[model samples]
Target chain A: MINRIRHILLLYLRETSFVLLFWVLVLGVLFAHFLFTDLDFHQWLVRYITTTQYPVFSIWSSVMLGAGIWITCLLGWMFKVQYAHPRSSLLPHYRSSHLMVGWICYLLIVIGAIWVIHVGGSFYQDTSDKQFAFFVAAVFFSAFNLILGYISWPTFAVVLWGMLCLFSNYEYFILTQILGEFLTNVFVLILTSSALLLLTWRLFHLKEEHWEYPYLFSWTRTSQRQHDALLTTLLDMVEKRLPSHQKHKPLKILRWDVLRFSIYKTILFFSAIILPFYLLYIKALSEYFLSFYQSPFKYFLLCAYSVIVIFGFHLRSISLWGRELLFPMERKRFIKEKGMNLLIQIYLLWLFLFILIILLPYMLLMPEFLMTAKFWSEILLTACFPLAGFGALTSLRDLSPRQSAFAFLGIVTITIFQMMQIKNLDVPILLMESFAWLFIGVLLIKMSYHKWCQTEF
Target chain B: MKNDIIDVKNVTKCFGSKKVLDDLSFQVGQGSVFGLLGKNGSGKTTLIKSILGLVRPQHGNITTLGDDPWCFQESTKEKIGYVPQMDSLYPWLRIKEMVEYTASFYSRWNSNLVNELIEDWGLNPQDRIGTLSVGESQKVSIILSLGHEPELLVFDEPVASLDPFARRQFLKTLIEIITRRPCTIFFSTHITSDLERITDHVALLHQGKIMFCGELDELKTRGNLNLEEIFLEMTR
Candidate 1:
């Protein structure tokens, strides 16, 4: 039994090695900071726990939430592969054993998290008081719900949970005074957690046979293929609904590019509609929270979102490169057309961002506050970094790991600079920085175009 | 020969330290069904891709239809049709939609031929490609390739996933196309029976080089055995 449990643990670790490596790198950086600076591990924990200020509280909480969600999704993926397969039919008893092992593994993770909190609290007992305890309990319960929800119905869980998150009043809910009197009691936490666990076990026992989960973990090799199958099915459905506009589009490549662009634009339209509502909801939560929103963190998120969308578009292009190139068009013409199409997409996205994030909010809710030049400059600055990234689409194949790291570092430095400039609000300096980025962006785009023209495939 | 549809001159290709194709050369005369036979991982797809200009060889040169395949012009591309070993048709698009998308690239598109193939193959124009079975998808791929009615057709293990009935139907279609027009066909496959039925000329690839390049009848006479036996013996 011990050997089997050990083997399962090893398998889980191997499967989640990428996420684990990310955590390791983050912890390593923290450790290095502690080594060089005056503040120790205990000091940092105290600061994190006690500092309920704007950026620190928001950044730490968001990072922790993101990490928890990522881990839950990965666990959901593993559970599907392990308990929900044809092989489980042959070895029925294995299901019970697997369930037992899975419970033990999960308990081990929870215990590990508790141990860290306990160690951190040992240095300063006040840090582990009611608020911190409630935070820990919330993390555990939410993780359980997320993983189970994801395992049961992926698209439903993702979309519904994502929508629910938009309406959440973080400041209103996380008031230490309000939460301290509520379900922050240790006894209540234990009872509720046990009940949820029991319910999960019963559900698993009853529907083990009929459990069908979508493969959402596209980073993993096996799951990537399954996810692709699911994507194709969804794409097929979407393709039927979209009009081809084939009459005006005489060129074949143009029609193809236009179809892809339409799909992308449609998604952006939905997001644009959702964004203003979400921002309004957040605004109503608290004026303090609104100030938190204006921080460099929002721009960082913008940059990240742009990178993700562009990366997805690039993946589609590269995957179809072979098939598309077989057509009669010159390689240069093909790439040039695709690049131009992508540029239109980027501009449309930027326009939507400007309208939804800037213009709409100012016109409707907070007219005078959002009209500041600093806010406008920050938005423009956000566009510059991602636009630079867009240029590297053609040169992505040639980008070495070192160059990528340097580029990431450069973005991080710019974000830090933007954070500092938030208080100062110097228009000349901001515009100068933006133009520098724009110049670099244009240069990279030209270089990539030249490189792509010379490339054989 | 100057009139040859595809001419290869000592093509060599390598990936890192491993050589996939080594000093290979062959020529296919116009209006001939040339079959390429090789064992699994014997660089059959690589060689086909090289001929199509999808892949570059480390050494030597290849000319298709009197132009270098590496820089094939639009005019040259218009004359070529290819069915890859793996069907890469967009699963998002329907048979009719995919056909339309592909047809737009060429000046001459035979919509009648596409519609006929779709109907004969028992595929609906409205059916999503993702919902289709492997054999059904392969049929769609074949239909898409043949829609433009190119002068030269290059197929890489095109019948691998096809059912026996579909395979026979495909061969019949191929025969019909050739009989209707003067065309050159180059195909690679492991199935010797299919090759024996259609191909006039044959090339045996072994260890990244052509072991035999001559008439199928001549090879059969020399070996005093069937095509399959000859293939198995040569490859073994």
Candidate 2:
């Protein structure tokens, strides 16, 4: 039984890359938490039990523990029936007896474990306190064992375990609080025994069906074949329907409409204008911002920077939507059209920011605020040029049809660096940046249009 | 009588240095069923795709209905119906919606014929295309191709997914339609038995060239050969 369990687990770990990555992330997070946080396991538990202010933390912890228990029990149930029953053309009476005996033995082991834990925990402490903790541990162990047994089961085991864990934990927490500790322990004991019997009977019924469960643990071979077949089928279908046509033009008109209809830009404008004021209000409430009237430039710079950053993020998201190819027109035309649409969007975004910056002097009742116009112009010019340049570069790359996370990250990094290197707010520098970007953008568009024209799919 | 509906002349196609379809040539006549027989990777599909204007030949020309096939004008497209080897119905749409959408692409769509086909095929209209079995999806695809009442119907491995009973039914349906309309039918299949029952003409494609293109009965009479034995012998 142990060998079988180990074999299945090894195959599962080998087959699923996500499962391997999940374990790596889990261990990494645990190591980081231990290194940085002053989280003594015992001390944390004591605080969790005593603190009234940390109800959310306590609830979350209880939920996790409860989930762990339910899953363990489900695993235990599945483990007891891991071996395949002999295939008999006719009904066999002896097979039923063997299965019944196995279930009885499994139940007895579980009861024995609970008894041992209960006695051991109470040997050092008072009898009443032992029940709640022991019951929780036993249920957790049973659920885990049942889950392990159902290795061949599809998503059902995982989903069932999750639901059971959530419900059992919530019930335990609420019942312990309202009915006192003793009643909660008694209630859990009754519930656990009933669930075990029901699950055992269900397992027996499932075993009666020969083809219900697959004998093999590893799906690696089958999954690869399925994937290859699906790809081949898709390629075959596409080849038959769409004869390799030269070039796909991006629709300029559609791109403009998408830009005009963008909700992200609106959100960015609001976040820029309102977030700084909200932060200032919070600082005032906390009595953190002393002499706000004297150091207004610092606040202005912070607000402007936040607004610029928000707009930059919004532009990045807008750039992503362009690759959807909403218009089935030629690829070159589509890219050119989308490029013009992006330019229009940038113009509208910059105009809105400029007007907001221009109106700041009147709102603040300070003529000196007009001095910051040079900085605002530099910020706008620096931000817009790079954004437009990146958009053009993306259109040039036209990495549509296939995109990776790394490509998106690279685009973001370029946009941020461009925004960072702005020293002057003079008209010449702004115009020069705009013209340079415009030339680069046009070059990218032309290059992309050419590439798109040549492409066959 | 010059009974040909499709004519090819010194057709050659290459991908880089590797020639996929060499100086291949064949003629498929009107009101006749032409069977394209080949082993895997024998350029039968490439030839079909070329005729559909999906692939351009490097040299020579193909004329379907006496017009350059590669031009693929709407007028040419309207007279032809194509059933690809794999079902290409959009997965998100219901079966009925897919039928309607596909029918809308053709100017001369026969709704009455489509309705009769849906009933005969025993397809549930409300079910989504994604939920269908492979055989069911193929039936829907066949119905879509036949709905337009095209002058030339092209099917690539149409009954590959179907069970024996469904396969027989599908062949029967095809025979019925062709009998009534006398449209040229060109289909590619590995199942020679199915072809033997209906096909009047056969083209054996091997290694990017046609080994044989003639009347099925004439070829059999000359050598007393069945398609399967002939295909194996030629391919081997």
What TM-score would each prediction reach against the true structure?
0.50, 0.37
Across residues B19-134, which tens digit of lDDT does each residue of candidate 1 receive? 99999999999999999999999999999878877667989999989988655666777788888787545565667766765565566789999999999988999997878998
User: Which one is best on lDDT?
Assistant: 1
Error of 2 at A404 (Å): 22
List model 1 lDDT by residue over A3-33, tens digit each.
4445445445544333454675488547646
Model 1 stretches astray by more than 4 angstroms: A16-32, A49-65, A81-84, A91-94, A97-141, A148-284, A316-319, A344-365, A396-413, B1-236
lDDT of 1: 0.64
Deviation (Å) of A392 in candidate 1 = 4.2
CAPRI grade, predicted model 2: incorrect
Could you tell me the lDDT of residue A162 within candidate 1?
31
Best by TM-score: 1
lDDT tens per residue, model 2, B26-83: 8888899999988878887788777766567889988887767654555666678778
Model 1 reaches what TM-score against the true structure?
A: 0.50
